[model samples]
Each structure stands twice: as C-alpha cells, then as structure tokens.
Target: MVTDETPMPVLFKKSFKKLPMWDFEDVYNQDAPLRPTTCAESLRNSEDESFRKAFLPNIRLFLHKDNINLTEWNRLSHFNNPFGFMEYKYADVMASVKLIPKPKEPLLLPKPGGDGCVRCAVVGTAGILNGSRMGKEIDAHDYVFRMNGAVLKGHEEHVGNRTSVYVHTSFSITTSLYLFKKYGYTSVPNDEGIKYVMIPEAIRDFNWLEGLLKGEKGAGPYHNKWPRTYYAGQYNESRFYVLHQDFLRYVRNRFLKSAILNSTHWAIVRPTNGAFALFLALHTCDTVSAYGFMTEDYNKYYNYYFEKGVKTKVVFYINHDYMLEKNMWKKLHNSKIIRLYQRTDSGTGTEKPK
Candidate 1:
C-alpha cells in the first residue's frame, strides 16, 4: 500500500487508542475520570447516561506524521471512506504530512499562571447572529472556533472576527468564496498566525491535503489552482493540523449519530462541520461557549448572518441531520457542558430584524 520512500516517525496512537501519548499526557485517565474545570463541566462525567459524551482525553485527536498507519486506514474505512479507491495512498499523504512538526493535537499551548482554565468560543454561520452584537463577547474567550462558509467581512460585530481554529474540508475552503460571495466573502479569515484544522471527510480532502502540503496543485475537480493560495498566504506546516479519522467516527457514533443512518442515504448523513468544531473545543478547552448554532427557534432568523434583504429559512438537505444537531446542542447547553448564545422575541415567536 505504501509507495513512497519518505521517512516517517512512529505513530504512537491507534484506532480507538485509550492510552495517553504525547499531547494528551497532561489530560487523561485510564478509568475515564471526569476532570471538569468549570462548575458546568463538572455536571456530566463519562458515567452520565442521559447526555451525549465528550471525546475522552485518551483518544487521539489529530493525525500527523507519527499518528497514522495502514491499520488505521483500514479501521477508519467503516466511518467515512477517505481513500479506498483513490490513487492517493497512505504513503503519499504521510509524505506530505511528514513535513509538519510533532504533537499537532492541542493547537493552543499551555495555560498561563497554571490557573487551569481554557475558554473557547465556537462560532457558527447561522442567521441568528445577524445582529447579535456578540463580537466583543466572543473575543473575550481564550480561543475562538469557526467553520464552513464563515462570512465575516461586514458582520464582524455579530460574529467576532477571531478564528483561533478554522475547521473545514477541502471543498468548503475552496468553494466557500464563490458560494458566499453574494454576502461579501472575498477571503477566508487569515488572522495573525491563525491555526487551520482540516477534517478529512472525503477523498477530495485527502487529495487537497496531498497537494496543499507539497505546495503544488492538487488533483480533483475543485482544485484547479494551487491549494496554498486558498489560505491567503498562511500555509506554514507548524500552524496546520489534520483531525484523526477515529475522532470523526467517534463523534458520529456517539453524539451526532442520526436515525437517517439507518436509511439508504447513510453515507451522506453526518454532523455539521460546525458541530465537529464545537465538540473539538469542548474536549480541549476547559470552558466553551457556542454562538450562531442551530436552536429550537431556528426558523426565526435568516439562514446565514451575512444574508441581505429578506430573512431566509435554514434549508435542510439529506446529507446532514440539522434537527438532530439542534436537539443535541440544546441538551449540551442545558447540561452546562457549553454555553450557547440565544435570543428570543419574548413569547411572540416572531422575527424582529435588528
């Protein structure tokens, strides 16, 4: 299967790996104990049954040169096929990532003063944030997470301009500009030294990573131009990260697994990219606040924060389970695992443009 001669470091992590390796050494327990930092996080431990679960600290969260192997490739095929038929082999992907530095899991470094607090803001693209005036509040967090078609050119006041981690697939990063140009999406956020995290959801993602890390034009329909140009000139390996395959499947299998999976369109059904970004923060940060995500009154606001003119509905496609995500987010918010930003019309159940 491996076709290249590129030297690789020994990947200590494995599928469903339950032992703490390099990045997770400071935060793991074999018994799966609850190390809650805030009063909210203390409410739900691994032993809790009524609520959805967070990724255990022992689980390998990121994929780097030393954290992936052929065995992992086989085990991950069950969740979402990354490269079963593509010409791109694990060897090629590894060769590309070999250039990256070690321990890419925790992008945020250690907390200062040993205060043991890491606060994060997971900002979504839902229209609820059109005029929320939450930019200052979001920026107050230690780190901010954004995903998918994040339109932030003119709406900086609503959704804070900070993008500590931007999680996306190759397709979303490449196509988001043209897809969201109607609302002033000229470029993806390029905050000073912002960390870029890739979710390897499909073959195209692997293809994109292959060409991206090598500083070359990647194969595939969407990748006509050099993949590096999409990042707006912030393509250094030290600031880049790839999420592990098992982490994705773990999220789907445990938290966001929908009834839609039992149907024929199972392959297409998965949690929203925003959901993934939110959970990643939950596992890493000591405290988390979610903004612009789906809520019970989702239909009240426009589909996206950047949309102009009339309000639009949150369109549902077969590929994603929006309702399932909404319920789970509500549960997590209620469970004190994360703080969700919410605003209502005060019993009127009507839309009032801000």
Candidate 2:
C-alpha cells in the first residue's frame, strides 16, 4: 500500500505489505521472483535510529509527474537545479518529462517471491577487480549494477558480464564510449529486462532526456545527435528511470559529506557516480554487495581496472574526494550496511593485472 500518503521511511519497515500483480511483466521482462518488500527485510523491526534514519524513503527516489510538485521543484533547485536552469526552462523540460512513463511505487522489482531477499552487486571500474576473478560471484546476485567506463569485453573473466542496471549521466555515458574505446569498449550494457537510471546533474541531462523521450534533436553535449542513436542498444521507456534530486543530495549530505563542500570549490565537489549507484542499490535492494569501489589500498592499483599500471597514474581530481569515498565505503562495510570487497595479499600488490 505505497500510496501518496505513505509515511516517512516508506521503504523501511518491520515487514513489507504485499501488492497486487496484475501485469507483473510490465515492470520487468522476467518472471517475478519473490523478494521481501523492504530492503532490510530481516531487520525490519530494528529500533536503531542510526541505521533506520540513514535511508529516508518518503523522499521520492525517482522522478514522476505525480510525485513532483512546485514545492519539490523549488527545493531541488537549491542544489544543481535539476529541473531547470539558464540553459533550459523548467516548462521546456516538462514537455519531454510528461511523455515519460510513470512507474508505480515499489519499482524495478522482479515480483515478490517466497519472502526471499533481493540481492544486488554494484560493480565499479577500479583496477582492484581487474585480476580478482570476481565475475562469477558478481553475476550471482539478483541484479548487477555498473557505471562509467565499464568495459567488459575480454575482462569478463574478472568483471561480471551481466548488468541489470546501468547508471550514468550524459557526460559519463558519452565520455566512457570514447575513453574506453581502446579497451574494446563499444556500448553500454543492455541486458534484456535491464534498467537505465539517469542522473540529471545539469541542464544537459534534461536536454538529453528531452531528446530521448520525445525524439527531439539533442542539444548541448549531444547537439544534433538523436538520443536513441547516442546509445548503443535498444531501450524501453517503461524501464527507464531518472534519479530524484533529493536522493542525490541526501547521499552527499548524510554519508559522504566532504570538506571540499565548505571551500570555494564546493560547487565542483560531488560523490563519484559509483557512489550513487551503490547507494541506489542500498535503498532499493534487500541485500547489497559493493565491488570495485575505492578502498584503503587504492594507491596500490591503477586508477581504473582497464588501465595499465605503468601507463596511467591514479589521478586525484577536485571533482571527487577519493579518500573520503574510500573511508565511507570502508565505514559502511564495517557497519554491515554493505559488503565491500577488499583484497588482502602478502605483497605490495603492484603486480600487473592479467
């Protein structure tokens, strides 16, 4: 009964109430596997404020016509101004947004099955996974999430070949195709029944979204490019989702609030895309395992799993706080919120990945 009146923390509860499944296939192309309604289904009754308050589901997770109002727009605009900006008017963005299919509450699930939990794996492109042989383990989850420069051709042996959800912004998706071209990267992963989550970081994303949903000619980064052709595979409108601005701001304010946000460069500082992908799974899935994220020993490996150790250095940029991300991932892992993959070896671990 997730309705407009669903209380605060709608996603967290002692147990999830069941929902009718008239057209289950409309949500996912696969058979509905039974999953508990709440992500932490087993600990639904936990009274721990620290854990329960960490994720506030009452705030919209995905953008839909019904969920957003004038007030919500004004609130969200205080940050990156996702709905509108100087580049585009809010009314113009809504024209295309109106065409987007409104997903019902309890989205992207495979249908509840036998009170089982929905397990997910969020895979990053860090070099630590290059030789870890974690492909089999990563693909075993109910859903696999990947983002940014995720080149999985020959290295399928290490990084799993499946991608249930691909999270990206206009910049990441477009730049990845160009940057990873040498590593056999062709297009974004498009598995049957897969979902695409777009993070509208700026006005360009809205322009791209407009082009995508309305078949309009793209402006900005993809000027003159058809949004559909910009992608590599077939996409279904029903399966696509745009992340709500509240969720993005929530993650930054609560978990990974870096020191940079206080400085003049605060506008430029934000969590990595991988961080958003991981958090998305945390709020949506029953169980989450994070792979290829920054760890304490990040310096021991190359910047990206696909890059050669000698050829590229692990460049630390102002856009993201790598050290803060590493510590937060470690903290979350230690807190049992997520299972972060960390490799322990005997050597300095500078060995080239096979």
Candidate 3:
C-alpha cells in the first residue's frame, strides 16, 4: 500500500501499482455512434484553406516586448470578429503580454507546420482514465501532451507510450515526487524530448525563476538548476478562457452577454491549468483530440488512485470543481467536440476503458 511512512521510491511504486488499464474496444464499439456538436463541427469545417486566410491571420502574430505596445494591445483588442472576439483572443494577449528579459519573437507559425495537418492529443488524468487502453490511439496523434501528476512512467500500456509535453506546477511536482516516489518517476522529466509547460499559479514562484537568472538566491524553497530562457508558455496570466470567452471571441461577440457563464455549474467550476495548456495547444496546433478527462462513470473510480488503502483524493486546491469537471467532460463527450474514451467491463470482469 502507498503509506506515508513508506520509503521514498517504494511509496511511488506502491501507489502506482494500482494504476488502472484501459479498454479501448469498449469505448469505440458502443451501439450509439459518436456525433460532433454543431459548434464543434463548425470549428473543424472552418479550419480549411480559404477560412484560414480570411479569418485567423493574427493567430500567428508574434507580440514580444519591442513591439508589444499598449497601442498594439489596444489595436489587437479591436481586432476581434464575430468568430473570435476580444476577451477570448485576449487570453493569449494577456498571457503573452508580460515577459521578463522579453522574447525574441512570438512562437506562432508562419503557416501551420508539422505533419501535413497537425493533430494533437491533450490527455488528462481523471480517474475515469484508470483502466483506459487508449495509449496506442492517443499516441497516434502527431503531438501528444499530458499534464498534472500524470503517473505514466510505469503504466505505458494504459495511458500511451509517448509524450511530447508534460505540464507541471511547482506544488504538484514536489508533491508527486514525494508521495509516489516508489513508482520510479522520481523527478519531472526535463530532457529535450519532453518540454515542460509552466503555469504561474503563484506570483512568488514566477518571481523566483526571474530572480535565479539575476544571480539572486533564497528566492524560495525551490532552486533552479536548469538553464534560464523563455520557457515557451511562461506568462503572468492563466492559459484558459471560459466558454463565455471562447464563444464571445471565437464564436460571436453577441455571445459576450450569453448565459453560459451563469450556469450554476459553470460558476462552481474554475478553469484548470491543464485546461489552459490544452487550449494553448489548440491555438498552436491545427487539430486536437482530448483523452482521459472524466467520463460518465467517474464516481466508480475514486477522484484519483493513490493506493488501495491510501486516502489521497485528487484535490481541488485550485478553482476547478469536480462537479464542473463532470459536466465539462459530459458536454465534450456529447458534443464530440473532443473524443473521450469510455470505460468498459471486460470478459475477465476487470474494469477497462480507452
């Protein structure tokens, strides 16, 4: 069992020993065929050639310090259209606004590059993904990004075999490395193959990184041992825009006053760091597929699995609510805006999903 008293690495191993495997066959084989929502279909259908030239020119605009003027900010704010409006477009604006030493140029592509068409899989670690066998399918995408306490080091058969990106928060890194050391994932991968996406959840944490390069110490408990430079998505703001912002900027401005934000459920759920990373990836990549988010059978599995007897519930220290997460997954599943693998009961009577 994953006990607090267990030795470091052993603890992680024990905790992950219970990592669930997925059943891909059951997910895609349901009697009911998956259907995309009108809104989602609209986004995909519009991603063609003529549409890109006419509508999303600025999607690739690079706004670093030298040219990142208020005039530019204000000008870009007014650049909103019916499809993607101000506030929604403003997330990348606000996030890209503040930079320390300043960036050389923006990271937007001149023309969408990489594999004739770019497809990505943004995998989340909801308990529903426990036994999901979507690894091969998830890996099939051109780019695969996974986030937040993802325990895939030893469970490759379930989550997938490759990862191009791993988003991490300081707190999560410390916590996971400490708690699940037994799983053999003793440190966050900082190697070249996997890029680290940093979310500035705390201002001090952000400043601490800034201070390191400045030759200052005692920034905080954590120290930077890696080279300092523009880590692709570092910014003061969050990386996610709510549906209201998504619709207002990406759909139509009239939606600015829509009631979606007022949904009691929407109010209850706060955006997650992983959500921000996924959206950021979407803006950069032409196509995206979402995996491992909650499915209809969430409660069946605990919010997360620490160990058979260990009591570590996947927490909500941030604004995100599990109930809201519940609804978002359902909405995404129903809309088919993104594909969510489903859990299945196998012949061995073992729990399975993909």
Candidate 4:
C-alpha cells in the first residue's frame, strides 16, 4: 500500500521534451529500421549496453620524451582547433577547482583515527540560505564547501559558523580578496581550505599566466594560497573528480554542437560550476545534500544572499542550460539520490522529504 510518505514514481513523457535529432541520435535510435523490438525496448537495451561500456577503464597513448610532441600532434586534429583548445585550458581550469583533491594528498581532516562517513555541506550564496537559521544544521555536517563569491559574515547568525573549504576562481579571489579580508573573511586554512576549486578561463590562454598563479618557484600571486589547488583525474584514480571539462565537452558534443553558439534562451556554463561541486561531493562523501541551486522559483531571489533585494535575472553569459538542469534535478529528486532545498518566502527554514 502506497502512503503519503512514499513518493510516487515520476515518468517523463518524451512528447514533453524538446531535444533535437542529434542529441537523440547519440543515445537514441530514430532510424533503427532494422530493429526487431519496440522503440522503448531498443532504447533501454542500447542505453544499458552503452552506459556500461562508455567509461573505458584504460586508454593508453604514446607520448614524446620531450612532452612537446603530443602538443604539436594535437594541433593537427580537427578537434585540435576549436575543440583542441579546450584540452589544456580544461586541465588548468580544473586544477583550481576547490572540491577536487590534490593529486595524492591524504584526506585533509581524517576523523579521530579515520572512522565515520565524511559529511560535506556544499553552500551556495543563494537567497535561500540567506535568513534561514540553517547554520547549525549546516555546521553540524563534518565538512563544509562554499563556492564562487561567497560572503559569509553578515549571514553568520543564520548560516552558522562552519567553513572547511572554499572553492573559487582567480578572478573571484583577485577581485574580492580585499573584501574577504575587510569583512573578516580569512582565507580558509591551508590545511583545511582545499583551495583552487575554480580555475580562471583567462589563465589558460597564456603559459606565463599559469606559471604565475600555480608555479611553486616562489609566491607569484595565487601560489601556495588558501584552498590549496588540484587538477581533475579519473574517478577513483584522483583525490577528486571534477566535471567542469567533462561536462562542458558533453554539452558541446552532445547538446550544443549543432546549435548556434549563445543563440538559445540559456547559456550552458563551462565546467558546470554547481554540477561539478555536486559530483565531487557525491564521490567524496557517502551522502550529500545540495542547497541554493536553481529551483522552480529561483527568479524570486537574488544570486547572492548578501545582496539585499529581489534577484534580477541577468542574460545568460556562460554555457549552462538551466532548463535542462531543472529537468535533471527533478529526475534526481524523484529518484531519491539527492535533496534539493526548497526556499520559502520567510527564509526561516528549508523543506525536504521526510
């Protein structure tokens, strides 16, 4: 017997979806004339097999002794031009992503002898977290991760007193470091900050810029800074797996390759900021909860809670497809895989399924 407490299974009708042919082709077969099964059966079987085989365990390639040979070789591929430019920049960009773990560093905070599920709270600077007295609830978790230009001072009474790691881009840090210091926002401790979660896209265009920010010869600008940095690698192989490059490629090849760039109602942000953070949490922690993402009523609040006033929807500048994100979130919510915080008008509390 199904009770009110039990969530009803959600079934998405294909008719309601607006995906194009190519997007469907990558995963679906609209021209399977030789198929002997129903469309649904064919889709399910094909998808099952593809998903299981998609992520290859090993891909070995020859590299030059000088390491410059591959870079020259990559410049020749069709992907090397526009798509090719993404490879290195993606690497540099990911290195700064905070949620990702350094190549082989030990877990920053091992529990009293290393026992217990690692608890992580990913905080976004949304109006939802504004006045809600969730600081205790948020701090109660073992580790906390804040992202972008997060301002934590004024909301302290409501948002609680816990900040383990801060993920930020060079742009965010450079432009706002003085404010963080001015507002009493200390750099998250080096031992605890897990710095460099967000990498700047500009740095990838110049080699000297990369050296300046990350090189260890001496402190350039961000070298040895708080929220220590890291680059992304295989899921189990690296300390953390960031989805920025991976997700950006997926959207480009899978969703936006054919569409006119920046022509749609929404722009798909590269490195999928929130999704990357969530992916890292999913891998790092046994359980995770995401708050302050774009909800159905997201237009009602400002981008950062620190700004007092209604949020005005700026035109989409990045590569994020918020509509697609909304659908994916709904599916995840229905599957009970993660919880999305529901904001109320009063900002006193958050709602989740019991």
lDDT (tens digit, per residue) of candidate 1 on 268-321 = 677778888987887777778999999887877778878867657788887788
Find the candidate with the highest TM-score and give its number. Answer: 2
* Count of backbone collisions within predicted model 2: 4
TM-score for all predictions? 0.81, 0.82, 0.57, 0.56
Q: Rank the candidates by lDDT, best first.
A: 2, 1, 3, 4
Regions more than 4 Å wrong, model 2: 1-49, 81-88, 110-115, 309-311, 347-354
Go through the candidates in order and give each one's C-alpha lDDT. Answer: 0.69, 0.70, 0.44, 0.42
- Residue range 131-232, candidate 4, lDDT tens digits: 666677777877777665556666765566565555544455455556555545554323333433443334322232333334332123444442223221
Better of 2 and 4 by TM-score: 2
Off by over 4 Å in 1: 1-55, 82-103, 345-354
- The TM-score between candidate 3 and the true structure equals 0.57
lDDT tens digits by residue: candidate 3, 121-154: 8887665555556678888876788766666765
Whole-model lDDT, model 4: 0.42
- Output the lDDT of residue 49, model 4: 43
Worst 10 residues of 3 by lDDT: 25-34
Return the clash pairs for model 2, or none: 34-112, 34-113, 35-113, 127-305
